[model samples]
Target: MQPLTAYCMRGHRQVEGWLQRGSLSILWSLLEAQRLHALAGDVAEIGVFHGKLFIALALSLTNEERAVAVDLFEMKRAPDFEQEFRSNLEQFSVPMDRVDIRRCASEMIALSAAPEIFGSNVRLFSVDGSHEYAAVIHDLNLARACISQVGIIALDDLFSAWSPGVSEAAIDFLRHPDNRDIVPLAISAAHGPLITGASKLFMVHASQVDFYASELMRMNRQSFKTRASFCGVKTLVFDFTNGVRKRIEFR
Candidate 1:
């Protein structure tokens, strides 16, 4: 696991958004690993603020794959956000033909024509839209419906003080009988001290736990000091030099 500095630094600096290097590294690793396993699917993000993480996803996509971005571009808080997002995408030379931009609230998109708009082959789904409990639940349900067999969903701002509802909603979804198949595979933190380190939690189908854990460990061996623990369930912790640690628990 070479420090994500080389892979993530350029995108992190070029795009102005909330995702930290550590979490971005994890996202890149997951996508790369999935590709290695010959997984076939597209990528998407619920809240594509300024296309920071969105651009990274776009760059990882194949010519046949699409990167869908859902957000309330002109209607919501950041009026100029959409402009900035396009500008950044253009600056990075992202292929507009393969990018699908939906300028609407995530809940609306989830309820309406999401299935037709986004096929059922989503490989990586990022949930960073409205942090409200109901919104999170809706987005999770949408992800469940659209994701592929080996797809991974990355939930942002989990357990953060600013949005306690995200944690509550995620727990609710996880506990629901209908969503039992979705389980947490790995957890990554944000960079810097201003925010709490832990920021994102990646999930996958219950059956693919071993594969996700092994692939993550193999790909990140250089950047993190890895250790395994058997506290009822197998747990792998990757402690990075920058103090951003990722824990993958087999629950």
Candidate 2:
């Protein structure tokens, strides 16, 4: 396995969260590619349950880049949520000084005030916060405002059986008259990009559609690939029918 894959796998297993194992390889591959292309910007994730995916993103950052983790950290089921999140970062040797932790509802914040909160030019944003329709729309707008030129938004629970609102909200968000320039790159489901184990839909600005779509195809890591319409935009779909593998490799 590649060193990134090994470390990501270790972190994914050790962390407490709801991320698919397959997502680690795909996320790491894309982030590394962004670095290779000199995409300099911060990374942010709303609703960081316990830093499972956040750690990998933070680790990928350059010395000048920062990672922001926004979460309410008050879920009844997740006792000591904030403490565990901090502990995980320390255990993984993440540079805590470079990470900004914000405790608030994502929708409560506005992008106009982002400079003080999220900074600017976010290259990669993970939108796993608030699966509700209105909240998803709000978060997407915020992401659109701060995304860098080569940025990609990773929206979790896109096709999840338990979170159908996520899919509804994504489609609704993209349909708005103001969002005509946004398009999806791929869906990390059984019928979409990457492999079958992930459950997020990756979207980007129309200008970036070809860039990410072509890159994912070039990777050639999917079991099957084809074209499909998601959120009213044409995109490449990759799927894996076999059970999760012991090891996954990304080109």
Quick one: best TM-score, which candidate?
A: 2
Q: Can you tell me which runs of candidate 1 are displaced by over 4 Å?
A: 1-7, 74-77, 110-112, 194-198, 222-238, 241-251
Looking at candidate 2, the ten consecutive residues that score lowest on lDDT are 189-198
Model 1 pairs in collision: 1-222, 1-223
Over 127-207, each residue of candidate 2 has an lDDT whose tens digit, in order, gives 987878888888888888888778888888777767778889888888888988878887655433322233677888899
Give the per-residue lDDT digits (tens) of candidate 1, residues 34-118.
Answer: 7667787898999888887888777767759998999886535555578888887887778889999888888776445666777
Shift of residue 83 alpha carbon in model 2, Å: 0.6
Q: Clashes per prediction? A: 2, 1
Q: Which stretches of candidate 2 lie over 4 Å from their true place?
A: 1-4, 190-198, 243-251
Which candidate should be chosen as best, given lDDT against the real structure?
A: 2
Candidate 1 Cα lDDT to native: 0.74
Clashing pairs in 2: 192-238
81 Cα displacement, candidate 1 (Å): 1.7
